[model samples]
Target: MLHDLGGLLFIALGLVLVAAGFVWQGGALRPLSTKRAQAAAMRDRSRNLLRSADMAIAEARRRAARDEPAIVTVEDVTRVACRHYGHLFVEREEAAAALRQRYEAADCRVDCMTDAFN
Candidate 1:
C-alpha cells in the first residue's frame, strides 16, 4: 500500500512541474507577441509610405515627359525624404530644412522643355 501511495505522489509532482513549465513558457512568449505586433505595424506603415512616394514620383515623371509643369509640394518633399531615409524622426525645422535640401538636389525633375521636345 505504501509503495502504491508513493507512486501516486510522484505522478502528481510530475504533473505540477509540467503545468508550471507551460505557464512559464506562456509568460515568456507574451513580450515576444507584443514585439511582433509592433514590428508588423511598422512594416505596414513603411509600405504605405513607399507606395505614396512611388505614386508621387511616377506622376512627376509623367508630367515631365509630357513637357508640363510639375510643381513640387511640401508633401512631395516629405515623400522624397521618406523614400531615402525611411521615416524622419528629426525636429520639424531640421527635418524640413534637410528635406528641402534633398528636394532641391534631386534630379527628379527633367528639363521638360529640352528633353521632351528635343
Candidate 2:
C-alpha cells in the first residue's frame, strides 16, 4: 500500500511538472529545489504519521471488542499523529528556525509541541 501511494505521488508530481513546463516558456525538466524537496518530505512524513494512527486505531478497535479498557479514542490517535508529525516539523521550539520559516510562508502556525496538531 505504501509503495503504491509513493508511486502515485511521484506520478502526480511528474504530471504537474510537465504541465508547468509546457505552460511556462521552456519545457525542461529540472531537479526539485532544496526547499521543494524538503516540503515534499515533510508532507510525506505527516501522511505517514496519519497512516500510523489509522493502523493503531484499527488495532485498538479490534482489541476493544474483547477488552473494555482498550478502547481507542480520537484523542489517542490524534496525539500519536501530532507527536510524530510535530517532531518532523520541529524537535525543539526555540531552535527550529527553518521550520518556523516554512510555516510562516505557508500561512500556518506551527508551534513547537504536540498541542498544535492535537
Best by lDDT: 1
Task: Please state the error at residue 79 of candidate 1 in Å.
Answer: 10
- Best of the candidates, TM-score: 2
lDDT of 2 by residue, 1-118 (tens): 9999999999999999988878896744896799999999877765654454454445554665442533434444445555655543323332233333333343433221222222
Which pairs of residues have clashing backbones in candidate 1?
A: none
TM-score of each: 0.36, 0.37
| Candidate 2 TM-score to native | 0.37
lDDT of 1 by residue, 25-60 (tens): 756443558789999977775555445444554556
- Of candidate 2, the 10-residue stretch with the lowest lDDT total is 109-118
Off by over 4 Å in 1: 1-32, 76-118
Estimate every model's Cα lDDT from 0 to 1: 0.53, 0.50
| lDDT value, residue 40 of candidate 2 | 94
Count of clashes, each model: 0, 0
